[model samples]
Target: MVNVYVLVTSVSPLTSFLHDISVVMTIQHPRGQPVKLRDFLLQHLDPAASHQALRQVKQVISKVLQAAAASTNKKLRTISRCVLCFQLLTFTLLFSSSVTPVVVQVDTQLNVSGLSNDAFDQQITKDLILEDTLHFLLPPLSHLSSHTHLSSEREGSQYGGCTGTLGISLSEDEFLLLLHFQLLMKTSSAFQPLYPSVSSSSSLPRSLSDLPDLLTQIEGFYKLKTNRSCRTDEPPRQQPALSSSQDEGLCVDPHLRQIYTDPPLILTPPFHPLVKEYRTEVTFDTMTVRIRPEPVSSACRIHLDEHRGPRMANYPVGLGNSKISILVMDGSHPEPVIMSIYTVHVYRESRPSLPMFGYHVMCSFVQDCSLLVQPGRPCGLQPHSGSQSQRNACSSGHVSGRWVVPCLSCSDNRTCDWREVSWQPDGCYHPIVDHPLLQDCMKDRKLLFIGDSTNRGMMYFLMERVNSTLEDWGKAHDTLVYRNLNRGRTLVSYSYYPQFWLEKKQRPTFRQALQQLLNRSQPLVNSNQTVLVVGGVQWLNTNHLRTVSEVLDSESLSNILVVVKSLGMGFHLPVDGIRSLSLTEIQDLYRENDDIVTTAKHHGYEVIDTFSITMGRYKEFLQGRCACHFHEVTQLYLSANEALPVVRAAGLTADVLLCFLRWRSFGPQNLPVTERPPQTRTEQRELYIHSAANQPCQTRSRTRGLNPQPIVLEDQ
Candidate 1:
């Protein structure tokens, strides 16, 4: 008998020979049974070989067996171990050759380290530093294919060997093979489908029937088997399957269709067929997902599985949470036909909290069709941290101030009071003194005043004061040169020539024409020729009064400096009838004029508050129709009296004689006589006739002539 037992331990000299014998045994025993060493040898030998040769081997085996039978139990145990080792080797070879190939690649540095025997030791440390240096120079993911190897082992095997196991031991090459295999798998796994490389020989079927039966089967799978069971806490019944037509319209996995239909859940396996293979499959309890199609044609429609029921329907297209549908028509065809259907998954939005008062919010779509909320009109909100809490007062609809009183019937005592008066001395009316310009003005200058009739009043008053102080010293002129330059109104010009000379003691020559009087007149007078008088007073009474500042500041008077007084002061009173106003009404009118003066002063222009001045001297003058009848005499007298304190406080000397003459000629004057006789019948009758006729009587003709008397006044 050919002895099958052979001592073939890893340390034995015959180990290599025994391995070769094992390979031969695997080849001989196709049924995976253990083969005897003699049978393995016989398969390789020719049939013609002598039986003596076989007998010789049998004799040798018999001798060895006899010795093994006689040997100690320890020796026998060694023989059994060798036999088991040989058997194990045979089984390993058979199993290894039958296995599927497993290839793994080490692509990244991290993966390369895994292939190393002791990854955390010297090899990885060196590799890591090398990777860092080369990282910048490395190509991107799309490029580069590294060296790779193929290694294969049986599905279940303890030992495997290469074809040649001479110089290289199996253990020595195992790690290297695994590393090379890892690289092969990695590179192959990264292979992407070359879509452009594919020929377009396959076209879409002309009709639904022409499509492969597999397509209908896939549609059926989506429609019938896609839905999954809801939680046990919910209803037990299954959701209805979508119709075949509906299934054909959507491209989705049968198992995932139900999950996608319910509450926009993030799919563990994403909807894309190619990506689905790479993702981990899991059931998430809660997730937010947006589903939309690529190359979204107009035939796109969005349907909600919950609200619109199981049946799919066209959704109204608009911007909102509502379902949307877009219809695509083929313009090339005489009649448009539906080629394909698409479903867009609209993104759901969470409701935002209401904005606080004074806060505004705006919602708009971004360029990428995403909803965006932005802060809009800000009320009390500032750019600081505290602005978030602030609310706009105007938006809150609350009033904080006192109520304004409208025009109302006045109480008997309160009729004259538009506003409460201050018993304290009025600060608005005060003596003017210590002006820097006054000293220069006092050095004998010609001042001309030119404007409307109201300006004539101001001119007369200024002339009176200067002339009265410097009777022989200054020459004052109020030449009645009224010319109508614009429309029907007259422009009055007043010029003054003083006698004192700063450089020479002689009087300067005077110019006659209004223009020459203004521009060429030499200073017989002070070098200062500027006039401090009012003009455009009548402009205040007209509608143009509102724009008085604009007119006075116009280019025509750009070279001159003017001091205006009570431009809007005079009020028109009704001459006739039942609408006659009382003293209180007249006072209210005066208050309105004061408001105008206050406005002018607020704008930084110099405005003389003539309200107090005129109110003091002419109480009855405020009552009615006094402005039209006011001649130069009354105007000059009032102005002189009013302006006296101003001029004195300003410390300017007055020409008293000239002042008297100017005042005397201002109006037909019974003129401020201290004593008067009781009226006779004829005198009383004349007054009655004059009053009734409302006309100036010839009896006042004597007063019209210019008075030449030099009057002296006592200081009171």
Candidate 2:
């Protein structure tokens, strides 16, 4: 579906490569190009993805055999060859799949059109998306941090820093660089030879009059640029009130009147530099606009956009819209030049996207870009805390072959490279167990976890987060003493129940655990409020599914809400910078576990996706030192004698998931009556009857049984 264009000769117009065999062309910057496509890509594209592609493209370009040919065709072929090489390189990069391909548009003649409403809106958006943007929620601009929300949980007083929607940006280094470059081209004596003799196109710009033609001539080199014109409501020399944002390498802050090189600006999110919301109050033309309230974090209202994808609530002008703008409104000039200093390109997600709701504000300033521009900038790496023998723990190398760059994540234990690092609420993360409301719900109930040692270890991680007292209550049927007494009455226990494995590993059999789960002999304790988390996929054999099927058949399945945890990532071999396991082996293992996840979901069991949790480079799981990327936690505790670090890393990610786990252990009925919303008499009667109908001690008919297959194990 992608149209391949070709330019056979310098003078030839673009033609489809499929239409003519001789129309092969290389990517070129035409004389009248509007933007610097190459420079923009090189500056904004992720360094990790760019590095991977550049390495591959270099190899391919080096290997392309050369031969004699017509001058025009030879040049065209070279360009075409390199384009092919780069595309192939990016194909590999697509595994990460966040980077988007840039498409450049060029016109031989000056292309101008009357701006339509849509076009005008697009221009306004592109103009206002400056370095210090305000797309997401934020607190008011006061120095007070209390009003500010992290993940959107706080809402308080509001204010106005800017009105009339007249946005001026706090231009960053890259923007300043363009200004500095053009300024130098005009004044620097060293550039005298480059200027053509007295032609209209070559005339020096006394002001902004001669820029368009001059830019057209310069467009043949740098490809990344935008044709932003400077013109707006003017008042000479008034101080502009744009949100202040500071980037690395730039000497001048945008708040002051100065000029310097603009470092490259990256607007991609959730990686874009974090800009806190600024609050202020201003009366514009007797219209005292009331800005919406927010905190460090709050629940963002969800609305279906045109594509039906979930977007934060939209509002009118000067309101709390999910956007921020920074522009330099230089009022000091006689005729103030209003340079629209921003650009935002939103890529539409494909249809049938998974729906998500709720968000909380998180805050952090953009890390100083000096780390990038300044070479060997002294990486203050910290050693991971570890075992007694290695108290210092200063070793740069890891126990396994995984070479994670420590400077990337734990940089001085203060700064990080990513713009906004956080765990999205819906993406395998949740609220904690100690919520004021959840605590009241758990007072009269208990929480039970049934899984292997990995899941048990995850319990330990969760135990740290939710302060609970541990106990060793070894019972006969479920003999493991993996027990915790939280809030005295609420008992949390992990019993080793390796499904389908009857072999003596000195733990209870799966059948014994199931019998205990059903409480066939004893009355079900706190049957209504109790919660069960099941995870035995790692140990399930091919035919072991029958055992699980039988367990699900019991009356306990319908009476209680069950939760399943997906299998953690396994390393079969090294692939895609992760040296832990083979690609095919890991995929095969995940594929097998997918059946477990599928069955659990099919039976209406809530599945906690551990796969996405382990994947690296997501906002919370930053590019480096993540579970999949570098085995971070494993690096802390892994030793040379261990099998490998991948196992430990996988365990650690599961542990992290526990931190994100919500107290969904009890249903709505378990909520303390004081906190529970009131129901009418009729509604309460219906609920009372419903609960009475599903009594646990009662028996059910055996006529309705699932048809599980026979235990055929000959292949083994």
Candidate 3:
């Protein structure tokens, strides 16, 4: 009952042609299921399938090759080459084998459209015919009972003892099958277009051009659902408190649900996670009011209006709450003018609320009548801190012609006057000003005052103050030559160069003066030995001023008072003076002054604001005169004496003396008692030098020449 059948199916006409080629080969097999030729040959012939299978395989291979020619992947091409080589080898082995005989027949016509050469097709056709002839004459053999027989025979042969049974070798078939299977696998791996679910009606596209319409519709639906859920799940917001006034009532009605839903309201979250609350109580002359929710937050804005001519507004009461306190005073009397207070709280998105808290009280007297309350002045806003027990002593009472009543404590309390109360809190106080460098200078160095008569006045005032404290200190002296007066240690020196112009009068330039001074005293003025204070020219009209810039251009004025003033002083003449002058003159004066200040700064000089200091102190005395006369000088000296304490406090310590000549008396009684100046020239000059003289100036060699020093006598 040896029966065999080969069934083949084809999707294209190419597969049918390949099947026709396979029918030309003849094979015999005992098969319940189809018998493979490889198994039959292993039992009879030494090799696997007969060569006739190669012809049919070639036909099948042609179709696969045609498919592979269309493929872009290099791996697919490699697979086709490997499959063709295996088929050729199988045919050679089958033709050499003397095992099972087989018939060859064509299964289908080959489709080689994708193949590049016709020579390959002709070679396959010749090979297939030759393999069929050998397969038909091969002898049949029985299956061996012992596995050793098959192993020994296979060891002597090159076919590796693999059986070509069941009409075809399973391994060989598997190789061919895998090749085609791989093509199927690759084809399956490609991306394919997806179709929308039929159940969705909204998936329809709006227009052929609107490719994303479906996605947009889905997203819109999702957003709508999310927003609705958010709205429904949110907690109701608590409303702020309102006054009992009918006008301030809420406008929402019971039947207004549709109105509420028509347009949803959006609210911003609080800036910080934690909620802050505060309370503030305000007291006017005759009224006291407390605002709700203190520390006004951005969520609430408060507006205040006063009936009086002057406008008033509510200020934040605390650090983080949305509350503001308002107090209105009665402005009817000349006593303390009070104003009417109206308070409104505006929510970020809602109408303003009425006054949450308020009250009226009558007061005996009003306080803080001015628009701008002066610092350190008494006002009712000050808290009573004299004693905890005395806080309740004051009582409120009604006064005639006053409608509102004041708090009992605020009305009768004398401490309620804000001007009398100090603004310093219970434990807080102003810091004392201290700089290490200033302290060191005051304690260790001798400062030189080296300007004009004004500088002399500053020196005198400083010296007087110092001498008053340290009785052993000597008085200041003025002379044309520099003199060191101390006998042993340098106590202090006061020298004067009294030329109306420190530089040559004809040249009138800072460069010339700096050069002359440096040439004469560069060693003394250098950083190590001295600190100089020099400024003068308040007396020079616009016509005679020599700016520091002109001087620096001519000579180096490094480390000098002239350089300091030129750099640091920001002084300009009155606007009226500049306007009155011609443009050319104005430009020249401006440029010269600017250059002087700049040069002074370049030299690292500390430009003391002498002009401002002098102007401010003796503004009245110098009101009408370009130069200070004897009387004015005397007044200046007196004024400097009075200002000595302030100067010391300012930390100016210098040794150089200042001198001013005037006809007024050095005695206190010389000037009118009522109109007496604040300081005299001698006193001011002495104070200035003493303040600067931390150490006394040592006496140096006196000049032994015809020009003798003028003797300076102390006032008895």
User: Which candidate achieves the best lDDT against the true structure?
Assistant: 2
Q: TM-scores of the models, in the given order?
A: 0.21, 0.29, 0.22
Per-residue CA lDDT of model 1 for 280-378, tens digit only, reads 211211122222222121122323333222222222111112222222223234544433333343422211122123322211111111101112322
> C-alpha displacement of 500 in model 2, angstroms?
11
Write the residue-wise lDDT of candidate 3 on 378-478 in tens digits. 43332232211111110100000100112324434332221111111122111111222123223322445444444444444443333332122223333
After superposition, which runs of candidate 2 have C-alpha atoms over 4 Å from their true positions? 1-421, 425-429, 432-438, 468-478, 481-484, 499-509, 516-528, 540-546, 555-557, 573-581, 617-716
Name the 10 consecutive residues with the lowest summed lDDT in model 3: 394-403
Give Cα distance to truth, residue 343, candidate 2, Å: 58
Candidate 3 positional error at 657, Å: 13
Candidate 3 — what's its lDDT?
0.26
lDDT of 2 by residue, 375-430 (tens): 22322233332212212211110011110111223534333212112222211112
Residue 560, model 2: lDDT of 56
Clashes of each: 24, 55, 125
Our tally of clashes for model 1 stands at 24
* CA deviation > 4 Å runs, candidate 1: 1-454, 469-529, 535-560, 567-588, 620-716
Worst window of 10 by summed lDDT in candidate 2: 14-23
